[model samples]
Target chain A: AQSVAQPEDQVNVAEGNPLTVKCTYSVSGNPYLFWYVQYPNRGLQFLLKYITGDNLVKGSYGFEAEFNKSQTSFHLKKPSALVSDSALYFCAVTHGSSNTGKLIFGQGTTLQVKP
Target chain B: GAGVSQTPSNKVTEKGKYVELRCDPISGHTALYWYRQSLGQGPEFLIYFQGTGAADDSGLPNDRFFAVRPEGSVSTLKIQRTERGDSAVYLCASSFGPGWEQYFGPGTRLTVT
Candidate 1:
């Protein structure tokens, strides 16, 4: 079965500290990975995506993600955490095998950046 | 450029009532999708429309859920016999095409009492 997994329900980090939100996926074909952030009461905002090439992908708000093909992982990372960065993070995948554009998303991880 | 937009921001209805959620995709996007997000959970795919027809509807929970993108620009999600379990934030998204990242709307929060 194709799916995305966010092992941690919540990740807390102190301001100015580096942060990581882990994600792993299982899919049949070549995977197109994505990271999205959701602020309270707002729609999900696109962070970054990995279609092919370049293991490291940078996105909005200084967010970046590393795609590890061997581990089946696409973990979101940031050089430093900010109090404003606290929000819900989700990892999603859509493999090349399907023509439909629907994405399969993980349960989500709540990132809490403490001051 | 504007992003995807969804409306009525919130909806409250009793069981067995019907509801309609609207979505306006970004101009020139051909692929539209619908998803549902329960509290604390990520969005789950409901359907995908490539052009005016549904390219995929396997994710829809049951027959009670239906969606249409008749003109290929705007879409509507319709739910019949609204059950408490069906209450969720219905999200609409669109992309240039399949394999691209989808941009989401704020979503319509539905409550079935």
Candidate 2:
């Protein structure tokens, strides 16, 4: 079965510091990976996705993710973290072999940026 | 352009009641999807509609859940004999086509008592 794993339940960083949210996956065939952020009482917003091409994918709000084929991981990152960037982050993956359907998601990671 | 939208931003219902949640996909989008997110968890896929047909409904937990997209532009998710466990944030999303990135709506939060 296809699945995603976010190793950390929460990640804390100082404002203006760099931050990373780890994600790993297990799936048959190639995978289409995605990152999403959910603010309190808000819907999950799309951040970025790794379909094909360059391993490093850039997304909204100055966020980016590195997709490593060998390691089967897609990690979300930001060079500078702002307090507003703190939110619940989720990693999801769907089988690329098929139409991007039925995304398997991770438990989610809470990001905290202290000013 | 307008994004996908869901109706009844919040709903409170009693157990055994029947409910319907509506979703209007972005104009010209051909694929619409439904997901359920419980508190503290990521959204779980419920169903997917491509055009006017349901392409996938495997994610639906049981027979109590049903959905329709008669015109292919608007969709409705219907629940029968709803239970407290069914209470969750029902999310709707749409994409240009299969494999395309999905855009989400604010979702409808359903509370059962």
Candidate 3:
């Protein structure tokens, strides 16, 4: 089964500082990875996705993620965090092998960008 | 684009009662999905619809949970004999197809009393 793991439950960072939310996955064959952010009282919003090609993918709201094949990790990063960036972050994976058409998500990590 | 939209942003119902949630996907999106999110947890996939048919319904918890996309644009999720555990924000998302990014709706928060 394809699965995603977000090691941290929460991550705290000062405003303007760099932020990194770790994510790793277990899957067979090529993996389709994604990152989403959820604000209070809102549904999950897509941040970025890594499907093929570039190992480093850039996405909405100044967010970027690096795909490491050997490490099986895809961590979301931002050069400078904003206080408004604080929200719940989830990492998801969909394997190319199965047509399950479902995204397996991580436990999710809460990001706190203090001002 | 208008993005996905869900109706009844908030719903409260008594246990054993029936409830229906609605979702309107993007105009041209061919794939639609339903997810359930409990407090502090990531959304769990409940079902997926391709066009007017359900391509995958394995995520549905049981027989009491059902969904339909008769016209292939608007979808409805019907829960029969709702239980307390069924309380959660039901989310709807749609995508063009596999490998494409999905756009999510605000979600319908269902609270069963």
The best candidate in terms of lDDT: 1
Q: In order, what DockQ does each candidate have? A: 0.90, 0.67, 0.68
Candidate 1 DockQ vs. native? 0.90
Instruction: List clashing residue pairs in candidate 1.
Output: none
lDDT of 3 by residue, B44-106 (tens): 999999999999999999999999999999999999999999999999999988667888999
Global lDDT of each candidate: 0.95, 0.93, 0.94
Point out where model 1 deviates above 4 Å: none
Pairs with backbone N, CA or C atoms under 3 Å apart (clashes), candidate 2: none
Q: Candidates ranked by TM-score, best first?
A: 1, 2, 3
Model 1 Cα lDDT, one tens digit per residue, B7-113: 99999999999999999999999999999999989999999999999999999999999999999999999999999999899999999999988999999999999
| TM-scores of the candidates in the order shown | 0.98, 0.98, 0.98
